[model samples]
Target: MSFRARTTAVLAAVTALALGGAFAAVLVAFNGLQQRQLDASLLAVARTEAVEVHQHALRFSDRPGPAANDIGPLTKFGIIYEDSGTVIAATYPFERTPPHLADIRHPNAQPFNFLFEREHMRGVFMPIPQHANTFLFLATSREDFEGDKEYLFRAMLAAVVVAVGWASLIAYWMSGRLTRDHRNIAAVARGVARGDLTARTDVSSPDPEIVQLGSDMNDMVERLAELVSSQQRFIAHAAHELRSPLTALYGELQQALRKERDAAAYRQAIQQALEATRRLKLLANDLLTLARTKQDAGESPEAITLERMVEDARKLVADLATSREVALDIRLPKATVSHRHGDVTRLFRNLLENAIMHSPSGGVVRVESEHHGSMLHTWIIDQGPGIDEEDQERIFEPFFRAPNAAKTRDGSGLGLGIAREIARGYGGDVQLDTSSRAPGARFLVVLPAS
Candidate 1:
């Protein structure tokens, strides 16, 4: 599902739960209030009846020949009287009356007011106040309280149903407002995935989080556009560079075969052709390595022993060093220092070759390795003319040639660029040290130790 739809669904569910809980709470509270009101009404009826009974007893105490004549209309209450420790009057008719003096001695045993149920009647009790040995009990039927409770419950249930419907409507409307941005973001993301690089999500609100998301996506697209454009330019430049050498070699080979020439002249022409072919071959190999590195970009990375890899790489370049009469010095710890292996050999090879190619004949090219905390530091120092301090930063850029070095040496100017690329791929970096102590040039390689 789309982001907007999912967000709406989750919000709706939450709203439903909140509204359901609220409805239940309100219903329970309303029922409790109703019950309290019903109890109060019952108590009021009991109090009114008690007063009437007390007045009647005071009026009939002197002329009580038969208690039934003094009794008045009891209304909804059932009345009973105890006189001389015997049942004197009762509003309820019974074939055999209950004994009154059985448990009347304990005044605290039953309070003056209490709920009572006898046969079908159910209500509260209120003792009549009189000096004579008499008691009055007044009660009404249970149906009155029960009917009130039923009505309150029905009304509460209806209110809860109505509340749920109204709450659901409000929740859906609010959910739409909240998820509107999410919908726009999703639509823009789809467009971007479908090759619309210019597509961008709208951030109409002032919310920081939403604004940040939109800004980040736009920044990513811009970066991607720049990268694609650079790649296109690099391919065109590389193609032209490759074609020039090939064209030169082809022309030289064609001229050599056109006619017979002196041995020295023929040798010179063949040597020039061979040199052109060799440069073309080197360019092709460099391009291939770069392409392979890019292809294997996101594979699993593991700790590689830098010391061992460096030693192996030096051994590979040993023949080249001997050809130039250059000495190699390797300084590394005994403990195994490690980093990612991917493109690490390339990084070392490029730096070592660049040093060797620039060094004077018989000059010593030093290869040193050491560990500094979490980083494995290695440097290739040459005894050639060091780059100027101002030009050090631009040396690693692709095809960037330093004026001093450009005058002294013939190079494609891609070695340092390739070395830096390799270093970056392995989570490391390459830098040129322009200090005075070892002033020829120091290509420092730093890789994270495992």
Candidate 2:
């Protein structure tokens, strides 16, 4: 069966068991109480008559039951008998023959149940204190309270039926409320499977556990959507970036073959094609570096100071700086860090090349550093045009380039993105210094120092 159906069935079963036990106990107790009351009524009348018989008053009522429907201490039959069970004075006339009495071993003055004249009756047999072998058997008809017992049984059965149905309904409703969050989560998962990345399970509940479960489910979906979106966006941009150079190289070869060309013209076409091929190779390497920075194990970690890492990166980009006639001003800090060697070096080198590429041919690109608590803060400030205000926030996104920023002959827009990812991998971050006054685009690099 389904969960809700099972839950409701179980609740109903438990309710029936509980109410059955309780009502049965009540019925038993009520019967005992009625019998005890009947016995008390019979005992009082018997003792009073025994006193009368001892004094020889011997009074008897004409008739009490079927005439009065006796509900109190009124007995319909009071018989005084001799020891041999013969010649007893009865309170009322018998319509037919009276029932034969059983011989009790001892007369302890306890009440006993019997039948009299086809009706249920209770009697108490007691021997008179002074009289030898003489006894009193006081009996009362129990027919009046039979109707009460029947009524009580019918009432209890009805209550059990109502209680089980009502309790089961309430339990089913509560179970549905509890599992609503689960249903919502399932819906979101199905939507995601159908490629609806924006689907979310925004659910609430009075139960704390359910609330937490819903929150966790929403968080998981959000993370999955983000990863999927990033992958899609990355593939789209990489395709666009790769298409430009690949098309250019293909066009160069196609044009060179379309007609008979001179040797110098052919050489020029080949050189242009080779340059496009080199750009494609550089773009591929940058994409690979971007991918590797996500996993720190791609390169081994080592102990290196901030100044030493920055100087190593500067050496790799020094040839570019010389070719562009831009001066490099380096001032390094003594702060040390422990991370993957190549990832750290590439982080700084990406930033330095980005600066050098944007700076004018003769402009200065300064690599400056300082210590901020346990972090090593480095700034690569350039003299080129600063980034557009609209593009400042987006520059570090994969393959994003500012519209107004200068582009060199060989460049991929993933430099800033790769640099930021590597820094963040080592518990550091790279950000543009938007508030800087003196220069073009000023970028800040912060890393934890060991």
Candidate 3:
């Protein structure tokens, strides 16, 4: 069955069961209360008859006349008898067996139910106060009591039917209202699946479960939209960056093919083409590195020593440092970090490459480390001209370059961003440390250490 239909059915069934149980309980309590009231009335009638009864001719009135307040035969009936089974006064006619009078002790009479002349009756055995060895038997028909009870039972049965039906109807309505929120969320999700990024759930509900779910789903869609936008921007930037080198390479080859030139001229064209190809290669590698850095490295952790990692990364950029006449100053402590060897090395290499490229000839690029609780901080300081304040903020953006970047060196501009992404993967971060007291820009990398 569909979820909404099942919800409606279950809600209706629960409401029916609850209302039915409540009505049944009420009926039982009301019946008991009504029976108690009938018994009280019967006992009250017996008490009045006792006070009016007399010994002369075994009658109720001493004046030898019909009593002023004697109950009729239909409403009440009884017989007075001696302990030896002799009759005293017959208050009502009997068409069946006389009331079985138990020799009850005075002041301790108990009431009972019995059938006489096919009529349901309530009776009591009473002992006379003044007359020794004398007693009275009393009974009353249950006509009014039965009639009221039958009426009440019929009324209660009708109430139960109406209450359960209405309760079920209300329950079905409420279930539909609740499930409507889920339906709206599903609709929004379907729209999102079809690439409609602006779709959102418009759910408003009092239920806490629905409130939290709708809030979370909307938040998820919002985050998804942001990610999609970021990915599109990333793709656009990557294509733009790739096109420059590709166009240069294509133009160099086309120029070389257009004319019959000397061997030297052809070699120069080939060299220019190779340089463009080299740039394109570097861009491809940097793009791949950035992509991989954001992914989970599904490998077991290795204990990488800080000093060794720094030297390994330095070796990758050793040729560039040598060509620029830059000296490396390493002062790393014996700290070990729990990370994949390749990931940390690549991260360090990217940062080192960025620093080495920007350093002045014969300048020193210092690599240092410090410990703070469980975290290790590594700083790479260079003796290069400090970045422009505006450029400093955006230097890590992919394919971005400083205004004078081409004068000093050629770069992909993804090095710092990739470095930051790698550090973030291992519960760490890399940032430009503007607060450092160093002359050149200082970059700080913070990572957890074992």
Candidate 4:
């Protein structure tokens, strides 16, 4: 069943059962109470008859006469018996049984109640106080009691039916209202799946958990939209950047093969073509590294020593440093960080490469590490002219080159961007430290220590 229907049915069933139980109890209690009150009235009537019988006996010279004169018999049968177990008078022409007389004469006999074994009859025996061995026996038909009980049963059943019907209606209404927000969320998700990124659930509910859930779902959709837009822009920029080198190589090859030339001329053309191809290869490798950095977000962390990582990165850029006549000053301590080894290695290598490329001849590129709380901080400082104020913030953006540094450097601008992306993927980050006390650019990388 639908949720609404099931909810309503469950509520109705519970209500019906509860009400039915209560009604049954009430009916039983009422029947008992009514029967007790009827017995009381019967006993009272019997007592009044015995008193009148005593008065009549006194008037008739100590011999009992008719016990009741004007009052009609309310019981089906009424009898007045003497101390010798003789029936003096009776409303109905019925003989008293032997057991009835024995019960009256019993020593411990008080007011007595019994059901006749052979017949559907119940009666009470009330003893007379001022008359010796005198007793009154009275019984009413059981049909009256049964009729009243049936009437109560029918009335209670009707009330239960009405109550359950009303309860079911209210439960259905309330359940539908409660699930309306869920329906709205589903509609929004369907719209999103159909490429409508702008669709959103604007529902507000009184339930705090539901409200929080809706908020989280909306936030997820918004993040997905942002990611999709970013991927599109990235693709466009990658194509434009990649085409530049490919076009230059294509033009050089066409010119070189247009006519016959000397061996030296052909050798120069091949060299130019090789340079273009080399640049293209570097760009392709950087793009792949960037993609991998994004894809390896949940890689398990391994124990890697920060000192060793920095040393390895320094060696990778050793050739460039030597060519620039730069000095690599490394002062690292024995600190270990918990991160994927490949990600940390790539991040550190890119940072060192950026430092080496920016440093002038005879300049010193310093690599240092420090332990700060749970984080290991590595600072790469170059003694070249520090970054200009305008390019410090945007330098870490992918494919973004500093206008001043771009003029002299022949490297792709994706090194720092890839480094930061990898650092962030491992729950750490790399940032350009603008507050460097030295006369060079300082990049700080922070990673969790094991």
Compare the candidates by lDDT and give the number of the best one: 2
- List, residue by residue over 124-180, the lDDT tens digit for candidate 4: 576666777677665555545557779999999999999999999899999899988
lDDT (10s digit) by residue, model 2, range 290-323: 8888785776778878778888999999999999
Best by TM-score: 2
lDDT of each: 0.65, 0.80, 0.77, 0.76
What's the lDDT of the predicted structure labeled candidate 4?
0.76
Lowest summed lDDT window (length 10), candidate 3: 62-71
The candidate, 2 or 3, that scores higher on TM-score is 2
Please give the lDDT score at residue 374 for candidate 1. Answer: 78
Shift in Å, residue 33, candidate 2:
3.2
Which prediction has more favorable lDDT, 1 or 4?
4
Stretches of candidate 1 off by over 4 Å are: 1-204, 260-266, 294-312, 315-329, 337-345, 358-364, 382-398, 407-413, 421-427, 432-441, 448-450
- RMSD, model 4, all Cα superposed? 8.0
Per-residue error (Å), model 1, residue 425: 4.6
lDDT of 2 at 407: 50
Against the hidden true structure, what lDDT does model 1 obtain? 0.65
lDDT tens per residue, model 1, 1-450: 854456556755675677667766876786567445544555565555556666675222222111111132223544355655555555533215543544333341132323333434334444565535555444444444456557766776676666666666666677677777766777778887787877877777567898888788778877877677667767776877788899999999899999999999899999999999998888887777666654555436665576677777787778888988888777766535344454676678778878887788888878777888877778889998888778876787655667877765445557787787777766778998655576589888887777
